[model samples]
Target: MEYIILVITFTLFIIIAKDLAHHKKKNPVLK
Candidate 1:
């Protein structure tokens, strides 16, 4: 159960990071 939770957390982190990156790219003014 612990391992599964860790995996889920990692996946969410990666997804959020990717989304932020995409948003920044879409709006260069963000940087």
Candidate 2:
């Protein structure tokens, strides 16, 4: 379903954002 796909995409986006934030905090070079 479209809604399910949307939820999946949103979840993936949040996960990626969290990972990027964690990486930035871990490595100052990205900041």
Candidate 3:
């Protein structure tokens, strides 16, 4: 159960990071 939770959180982090990166690319002000 603990391992499953860890995997879920890791996947969420990756998705969020990708979104942030996409936003940064769209808006140069973030840089």
- For model 1 the local lDDT of residue 1 reads 69
Q: How close is candidate 2 to the true structure, as a TM-score?
A: 0.89
For residue 31, model 2's alpha carbon misses the true position, in angstroms, by 5.2
Better of 2 and 3 by TM-score: 2
Residue-by-residue lDDT tens digits, candidate 3, 1-31: 6999999999999999999999999998987
Cα-based TM-score, every candidate: 0.83, 0.89, 0.87
What C-alpha lDDT do the candidate models reach, one value each?
0.96, 0.95, 0.96
- Point to the candidate with the largest TM-score: 2
Clashes per prediction?
A: 0, 0, 0
Better of 1 and 2 by lDDT: 1
Model 2 off-target regions past 4 Å?
A: none
lDDT of 1 by residue, 1-31 (tens): 6999999999999999999999999999987
Lowest summed lDDT across 10 adjacent residues in model 2 is found at: 22-31
Model 3 CA lDDT for position 2: 100
